[model samples]
Target: MDKIVQFVQKSEHNATAVAIFGAIGVAVVALKALSFLKVLVDVFLRSGINLKKYGAGRGGWA
Candidate 1:
């Protein structure tokens, strides 16, 4: 992390550009984490309609 900070500080890139790119990267990672959490909650905590009640294995559409 120190190396990264040094590189960014020493590079010729504009500060605003670096800040914008960093913010975009952070937003992407955060959104991905939130999406994964949502999937986990849906899979483990949420309940779905009972397919058996709709005759799922009897050839009728569930």
Candidate 2:
């Protein structure tokens, strides 16, 4: 496709910009993956969570 060709032939500045944006995108995706794994592990592993023992989250509404 024409767009692919243009992307392949991008100027140095554009290429650098693309690389930086791509790195940022990768980091965001990795963070999301890590968060999902954390939630999955908590769902399967965290047991007998006594919020009652912790008490009503500093109750007494303002």
lDDT, candidate 1, 6-59, per-residue tens: 877886675567889989999999999999999999999999888888788888
Per-residue CA lDDT of model 2 for 2-62, tens digit only, reads 8965985777777788789989999999999999999998999888576765565768343
Cα lDDT, all candidates: 0.87, 0.82
Clashes of 1: 0
Model 2 Cα shift for residue 23 (angstroms): 0.5
Off by over 4 Å in 2: 50-62
Q: Which run of 10 residues does model 2 get worst, by summed lDDT?
A: 53-62
